[model samples]
Target: MTKLVKPVIDQVWLLRWWHRHQAQRLNREADAIRNGLLQDLFAVRRQLELLPGSGGLAAVEHLYQALDALGNRLSSPYLHDSLPLAIQQALADWPPQVPTRAELPSHWPAEPVEHTLLLLAVLNHLGQALAAQPSLPQVCAVSLTAGSDGQRLTIAANYASAVPPALLELDQSEAWRAYLATFDLFSQGRASSAHGATTLRWAFVW
Candidate 1:
């Protein structure tokens, strides 16, 4: 009876040790995952800060040239007579075959040429990002909503399925960095993702 009792006690002790070991290992793994997530978040924020908005002065120069050309055309009596045509010609061209579609205001408020160009760059980059991920759903949806006073812009991208890994990887790529730099003026912005969608919300004094 004494010998049998010793074996039973040993077995219980071994089981308890194994359980504790597994719990510790799981805790370590959870901590590692949390640390990794925090690191990625900080990295993204740093990248955003370093990116040159609108390609810095060079992009500004190009925008000015475009505005100048448009101004010259508008100065002409024939072109000035047709304001709508002039405005349409001055605006940026939309891309072809983007799976994601944008819902913008019926009439975008008049903004400075530089601001318009920046907005166009953001849209172009978003389209390119979606195009790069073939695994994305056939019909992704993008919507841009402006505040009542036009002081803010909310850009949302909703996916029919989970966002592809490749698309998420773009956040660390050089091309994405360059594209983000063009939004330097929009420093006060926040981005978030959940439930197969991502949203960028930006606020400006304007």
Candidate 2:
């Protein structure tokens, strides 16, 4: 096994940790804003009701619509309550041709937010790779299984031929190396890609 230098591992770990922390903080802030705006809109609507004027209430309704649309545009719910939902949310932006099929046992354990972020990064990387393929495969399979030790994730690209060049580049890139090191730091995990398949297994130490 090729060992990563301690300093490199620490740097990668810190970067990932900082990213997740900022993302979570931003999500909280956005949620607070959305909630506060909704409350203010409700109060405005109630006040408009007493004015006996349709124009005021209509304008308030327009503001409500705008706020709702803006909330949807912002990626605030970065982490979801369940692994499946998180995975689904991550895959929502992926190319439709390389859609993912996630399999999990009933009531799958919710992973830590950091772990979930890592997993989402991995999935996003794969999605980009698959989208770059010359002839995209129709199905990408992702399965999660749990054992006494921890959780294991298996992703099969199911390419008709050997692994795509785009996918190989992503797997071997320096950026991905840092991400892998961060995963190792958090979960004592290891990742491997063979042919068109990728696997990640890590203990739930956190």
Candidate 3:
């Protein structure tokens, strides 16, 4: 394997907007990204028009400049980084596609243990944040309420602030590992033994 480029701390997916500037480059390379190119362009144009004229326009313009800089620095998510340039070109334009039974790629990414843990940590962090705002209504946890009660809560079991039950069983959570497994990496890799809703709010970065 080539040396893994250390990931930039701040990462953002550009979604369909990036292609507008590279429409021809994308169409010539990744048809999957280009398959519905015209439609996506229209959608982005619509969004730009909807941009508010006051502070929002300036904020969004600045956002584009920042993303352009990030794109120059970071090409893609770490998981997709290792693909051959040919594949990278293909993925650059990967919009959703309909697949014939035989067309699906034999290899695809399954949610790995680490990624799952990270997602859990994020959910846990969000849950805690929502939990703090009583006006937002109680966002309960599946591991807490079994996700069956129709309590009209704001969040889904797909994401919550509690450490996911699936991740809580790791053999020896080295602090942050446990928290990240719950979807809240607020402390990055430092909040080793935190508990309750404040896990992220008071995370120790040491």
Candidate 4:
């Protein structure tokens, strides 16, 4: 019995290949979705009561709002930038764009809920309603803090309350409807769906 052996000449590592494909980070089409659709939804948070500004929320504030709205107090809206390829592509096909730090022309989703959670969580976590204070995480934005909680997710600041009308319309679009349909939180709640006994219950204020 004989075993064949090949000599390793200047072995190349996985890091080299990883960095090679990571060259182009920005996806203009994804950027278009964010600037076009994601930011606009920022204004919708104004409709929420007892939280913060009712006029409109800035990009950074919207980021926080999106987080809380998704039901997880501890999660990273900034991580949306590094989402799996499949989730990215699902968002790209979402008709309207999603405002995100990572902008990609095409990406797919490992789980549709992951993409939706990223989108909704960012806006829900918005703290204030001002645009002057730009805290929204961008593509280059990475983990500046070790924790992903209230004080951890953001530092204190005031955000502008100017409404971006164009973005809101997309939120109401049938396409957005399709997008939201992919997530469960946005789903109509079932009496049995409560998150255990400790879960805070709310009375709808109509």
Candidate 5:
């Protein structure tokens, strides 16, 4: 009987290879879904828009509005060269009840597309989580700062009663970290809550 042995580097190399393949596959699928599917949906929407008035014209208009909203959500958001403006656009649709305050700098350079997208996703997810909570926070403060090494986003919320459990769970989820790793963007997030107040902060380095 004999046993086979391999260096630890072999395992590391294999993991890296597997991850690379997975990333490539994900990118391909995302591209196909975004471009191919969206194009078809838009074509249908255009046809619906051109239809003459009929018994279902009202229904058709409603369908068109639904399709338009879907298209807006599915399509990529444009990022302006002014990072502050881009961030503001991303937060424009945030929940009004919570009263968010964004402290974004006016002059920072535009971030990488991946960075921009990830920021949007995180913010949107947070907004959804907050909206689902029965008790809304008094205020939600979001601040973006650029240091010599990197940039940071700090989100703090003050709830007059208690911090929502869902927010804590979402903060601990691995999805955000996985997204960062997939995009090869270094990021760190910290969450803390006490006395009906909570803060989550994420910093990114290029």
Candidate 6:
């Protein structure tokens, strides 16, 4: 009877040790995630400070959208879904006054939730750019194209007139560039005159 009791005690001790070890590992991972969230918050705040006076309202709205996205990401860190569908949903959510025409493929490979959120941020910036135009056209067009390799995506927004220099300045800022670089995304913008109109073009690849 004494020998049997010793084995049982040893089994219980091993089980408790394993549980403690797993708890410690999970705690470490949680701490790392918390630190990341804090860093993102700081970056958003810095971006807000860089906005011009005319863009104050738009910047505030962008910050709120980012916070909402982060909250959703925190709740479900590993979400995977289609990127095209996400962009469509964002376009649908836009205010009725802003007429937008979107051209997106029916389907594409799904990506991590955080990636989708970052793409949404880019879309928000484009929308703000369209809004900043002194006289918005009857319709603005947004087109998205994906590379054959499935490793690259492009978003283009065509505005009726040249976008405000102040709005473009935000996109050219060091903070904005760094934020996109942190996610391994690259972007560039150009302005061209054709016929009698100017078009602001921005290209993003990841």
Candidate with best TM-score: 2
In the order shown, the candidates' Cα RMSDs to the true structure are: 23.0, 8.0, 19.9, 20.8, 6.6, 16.7
In model 3, what is the error at residue 73, expressed in angstroms?
A: 32
Q: Put the candidates in lDDT order, highest first.
A: 2, 5, 6, 1, 3, 4
Once superposed on the true structure, which residue ranges of model 2 sit more than 4 Å away at CA? 1-20, 37-80, 196-206
lDDT, candidate 6, 26-126, per-residue tens: 43454455457646756666786777754565665676566555544332232245677767766665556668777777877766444555666656655
Please provide, for model 5 over 121-187, each residue's C-alpha lDDT reduced to its tens digit, 9 standing for 90 to 100: 6677767767777777778878888777566666777666667777667656687455545434222
Going through the candidates in order, what is the number of backbone clashes in each? Answer: 5, 0, 13, 34, 0, 0
| Model 3 per-residue lDDT tens digits across residues 166-186 | 333331435435443433232
Give the per-residue lDDT digits (tens) of candidate 4, residues 1-206: 99987765533434333322332122333444455555555545444544666443455476645544332223223234533343333333322322333333233323223333434333342212112222321111111122232111111211134223432343355644443342223223111111222221111100
What would the TM-score be for candidate 5 when compared with the true structure? 0.56
Model 6, residue 192: distance off in Å is 15
By TM-score, the candidates rank as 2, 5, 6, 1, 4, 3
Best candidate (score: lDDT): 2
Screening candidate 2 with a backbone cut-off below 3 angstroms (N, C-alpha, C), the clashing residue pairs are none
- Model 4, 6: alpha-carbon shift in Å? 55
State residue 3's C-alpha deviation in candidate 6, in Å: 32
TM-score for each model: 0.42, 0.65, 0.18, 0.20, 0.56, 0.47
The digit string of per-residue lDDT tens for model 1 on 34-64 reads 4554355445545655777724545444554
